[model samples]
Structures are given as structure tokens and as C-alpha cells.
Target chain A: EAGVTQSPTHLIKTRGQQATLRCSPISGHTSVYWYQQALGLGLQFLLWYDEGEERNRGNFPPRFSGRQFPNYSSELNVNALELEDSALYLCASSLGSGNVETQYFGPGTRLLVL
Target chain B: SQQGEEDPQALSIQEGENATMNCSYKTSINNLQWYRQNSGRGLVHLILIRSNEREKHSGRLRVTLDTSKKSSSLLITASRAADTASYFCATETWNTGNQFYFGTGTSLTVIP
Candidate 1:
């Protein structure tokens, strides 16, 4: 089975610009999660989407938002990007909230903000 | 901060030896999982131990959980150079809605 897949393996944006990262969950998965892995900040949860609803989000600012489509795909949008926004954004998916013990991750989209 | 913290920020060991890493989290969790990432890439799920469970093993990887201490440990036995990577512990808290927080990671280097 194909694992979670993400688009734009690498992205480059300038300060104050906006960036969009996409993720396609594995087949039959209903929950999609977004995370940011900065150099030293570790892996911080960004957003959680299950069944087309935004269940929860992390401590990130409002400028960081995302949505899940009907097909269980997700899109993460970072507005007013700053240099600090540069990091590898990872996407993961699971069966659902009831079976989230295991999450399969995508290769991640490396966003570099200049 | 629900993020977990891993001990021994880095470790270096020779191949065929054993490598152990520990993680401590802040809140109570439903389950804790271990993941491996090679060169800052996508993470590969290694093992998951439920709050009610104490230990689990997968191939050469062994995991132990101490809910009372809110800590978990990952042991990779008979390591190989290819096993070199950053190991992380992720916690799925009880109250959180399907959110899993991760640690800074333990960088393990297996020397040949």
C-alpha cells in the first residue's frame, strides 16, 4: 500500500509571502495531521483534520492554518511567512481518531523562507 | 507543552552493540509511540505502547513504558550502521483530539 504522500518536496518563499503545502493520506485513512519540524524546536503539531473537520491545532499562530477536503487530502497554508517559518513540514495519516495509535508519515515538504 | 523530551541528545555506538534512549512527557497519555527518521526525512513508525501496557518489541527494537513516571524507553539491539538515525518519542494524550506531540529526538550514530 502507498503511504502518505506530500507535494512540492521542497519550497522556497520570501518573508511576508504565503506558502501552501499539500498532503494526500493513505488509502482508507480518514485523519490527516500536520507538523512542523524546525532545526531545534522538534516536531510541533500544527493541525488535525478528520472527516473534513478541523479537530484541533497547536500553539502556532493563526497565520498558520489548513483544511481537509472531502477526499481526505489536506492543504497547509502559512501566511506572512517569516524566516523562522523555514522547516520541514510533515504530514501524517491514520485510520481515524479511534485508531490513531499508529500514524504513517509523508516524506515532508521542506519550506525555506528567506 | 505536550512535547516530549528525550535524554542523551546524542549517542554514538559501534555496530553490533545496543543503543538505548529514553523519553519523558508532561501529560497523561492514551499511548506512546516511537518513530525513526533518517536525515530529517519522513518518520517511520517503530512501535506503540498503550498506557495500560508496559512493554513491546518489534524485531530488534524493544520499548518500555512507565506511566507512573510518564516516561518511555526505546532499545535497539545489535545495531547496524544503517540503523543510524534520529529516534523520537511521540505521545497521544488522553484529552487531545487525535494529536500526537513529539520530542526533540535522540541522534544515534552506529559506527562500523
Candidate 2:
């Protein structure tokens, strides 16, 4: 299987700018999750989309938003970026909801905000 | 609030040795999963232990989950240099939908 794939392996933006990151889940997977791994920190849950609906979100701000397409791919948009927004944004996919499956992750998009 | 907390923020061990990391969570969970991240890349699912299961093994990895204590431990036996990476424990909270809260992670460096 191809697992999961992400685009623009690395992104560079400045303060007040906006950056968009993309993620494509594995085939047959319905759930897409977004996480931010800041340097020296753990993976912080961002937003989750299951079956094209917003399922759950983490403690991030309003500017950090994303959507899941009909094809199960996702896009994360960070507007008015700040230097603190620099981190590795990861996307994960799973078979379905409930306790029956495990999440497979993408290589992630490294965003560097200056 | 983060659901899991891992210990020994970093670990370094020699090849052929055993590397163990611990995780503790706050709420009830449907299952707990362990993932490995090489460098700053995406996570690779290592193992999953359900709330009813005690221990599970895959290749050289052993995972033990204790529902009573709400804690889990991952042990890598006869480790190789390739096993070096950051390991994180994530929890799928009961009734919380599909969100999995992850801990900070343990950076393990296996020396050859």
C-alpha cells in the first residue's frame, strides 16, 4: 500500500502571510487527522475530518483551519502566520471510526515561518 | 489538555540492548497506540493495544497496556541502529470520537 502522502515537503512563509499544506490519505481510508509537531514538543492534535465532516479539533487557534475533500484528501490553512507557527505538520489516516483501526501517517509538511 | 505523558524525554542505548519507554494517560480510552518518527518525518504505527488486552508483540517490539493504572509501556528488544527514532504514545479516548491525543515523545538513539 502507498500509506499516506503530503505535498510541499517544506514551506517557507513570513509573519502575517498565509500558508497552505495538503495531505492525501491512503486508499480506502475515511478519516484524516492533522497534527503539529513543534520543535522540542510533541505532536499536537489539530483538526480531524472523517467522511468529509469536521470531527474534532485540538487547542489551536481559529487561523489554523482545514477541510477534507470528497476524495478524502485534506488541506491545512494557516492564516496570519506567526513565527511560533513554524513546525512539522503531519496528516494521518485510518480505516474507520471506533476501536477497530490504527492511524497511518504521512511524511508531513515542514512549515517554517519567519 | 494532552491525554498522554511520556517519560525519559530522551533515551540512548547500545545495539542488542533493551529500550523501554513508559506512558501515562488521564482519561478512559478505547485503545492506545505507539508510533515511531524518524527525524522530523511522519509517524509510523508500531503497535496497538486495546483496553481489554494486556500485551501485544510485533517483530522486536512488545507493548503492555494496563487499564487499571491507565498506563502503557513499550519495550524494544535486541535493538538495532535503525530503531533509533522518536516514539510517541497516543490515546483514543472513549466517547471522544476519533481524536487521538499524543504525548511529547521519547527520542531513542540506538548506538551500533
Candidate 3:
């Protein structure tokens, strides 16, 4: 089975601009999660969407937001992007929003903010 | 705050040898998972140990959890060069709505 898929394998955006990254979950998966992997830092959870609803978010600012569509795909939007926003944004999917289920991840979108 | 914290930020070992990493968390969790990421790629789930469980094994990887101490450990035996990567521990809190909080990670280097 195909794993989670993400678009724009790599992106470059200028400071103060906005960036949109997309993700498509694996087949039959209902939960999509977004994370940011900054250099030298661990993966930080950004958002969680279950059944097309925003279930929770991380400590990131409001400028960082996203939504899941009816088909279980997701989009992460970073507004007023700063150079610190540069990182590899990953998307993962699970069978459900259960703490015990394994989460499969996508290749991720590398966002470079200048 | 990050739920997990890994020890020995980086490790270097020869191939065929064993590598071990440990993680500690603050809150109670339903389960804890270990993930591996090579270079700048996405993380791959390695193993998960439930709070009620003490240990689990997958191939060359073995995981152990100590709920009392709120910590876990990952052991990779007979390591290979391909096994070189950053290993992270993530925790799923009982009250976090299935969300996972990850650690800074342990960077392992297996030299041939």
C-alpha cells in the first residue's frame, strides 16, 4: 500500500510571505498530523486532524495553521513566514485517532524561508 | 514542554556492535513509540510499547518501558551502516487526544 504523500518536495519562500504545503494520507486512514522538523531540533507536532476536524494543535503561533479536507488530505499554511520557519514539514496518517495505532509518515515538504 | 528527552545526544559505534539509547518523559502516557529518521527525511516508526507493557521486539530492535520512571530505551543489536540515523522517542499521553510529543533525538552513527 502507498504511504502518505506530500507535495512540493522542496519549497522556497521569502520572509513575510505565505506558504502552503499539502499532504494526502494513506488509503483508509482517517487521521492526518502535521509536524515541523527544524534543523538540530526534534519533530514538533503542529496540528492534528481527525475525521476532517481540527482536534488539537501544538505551541506554534496562530500564523501556523492548517485544515483537513473531506478526502482526508491536509494543507498547512504558514503566514508571515520568518526565516526561523524554514524546516522540513512532515505529514503522517493513522488508522484512527487512537493513541495505540501506528502512524505512517510522508517524505515531507522542505520549506526554506529566506 | 516536550514529553520525551533522549540521552547521549550522539553516539558512534562500529558495525556489528550493539547500540542503545534511552528516553525519559514527564507525563503519564498510554503508549510510547520509537522512530528513526535518516538525514533530513521523515521519521519511520520503529516500535511501540504500551504503558501496561514492559518490552517489545522487532527484528534487531528491542524496546523497554519503565512507567514508574517514565522512561524507555531502544536497543539495536548487530547494527549495520544503514541503521545509522537519528532515533527519537515520542509519547502519547492519556489526556493528549492521541497527539504525540517527541524528543530532541539521539544521533547514532555506525561506522564500517
lDDT of 3 by residue, A1-114 (tens): 889999999999999999999999999999999999999999899999999999999999999999999999999999999999999999999998765978899999999998
Positional deviation of B55 in candidate 1, in angstroms? 1.3
- Candidate number achieving the greatest DockQ relative to the actual structure: 3
- TM-score of chain B taken alone, every candidate: 0.97, 0.98, 0.98
Q: Kindly report which residue stretches of model 1 are placed more than 4 angstroms away from their true locations once superposed.
A: none
Clashing pairs in 1: none
Q: State candidate 3's DockQ.
A: 0.84
lDDT of 2 by residue, A1-114 (tens): 898999999999999999999999999999999999899899999999999999899899999999999999999999999999999999999986766578899999999998
Candidate 2 C-alpha lDDT tens digits along B32-85: 999999989989989989889999999999999998999999999999999999
Q: State candidate 2's DockQ.
A: 0.81
TM-score of chain A of each: 0.97, 0.97, 0.98
- lDDT, candidate 3, equals 0.94
Q: Give candidate 2's error at residue B78 in angstroms.
A: 0.6
Please give, for residues B12-102, the per-residue lDDT of candidate 1 as tens digits.
Answer: 9999999999999998898999999999999999999998999999999999999999899999999999999999999988778678989
Q: What are the TM-scores, per candidate, against the unseen true structure?
A: 0.97, 0.97, 0.98
Residue B13 deviation, candidate 1, in Å? 0.4
Considering only N, C-alpha and C atoms within 3 Å, which residue pairs clash in candidate 2? none
Per-candidate clashes, comma-separated: 0, 0, 0
State the weakest 10-residue window (summed lDDT) of model 1 chain A.
Answer: A94-103
| DockQ-based class of model 2 | high
Residue-level lDDT for A9 in candidate 2? 97
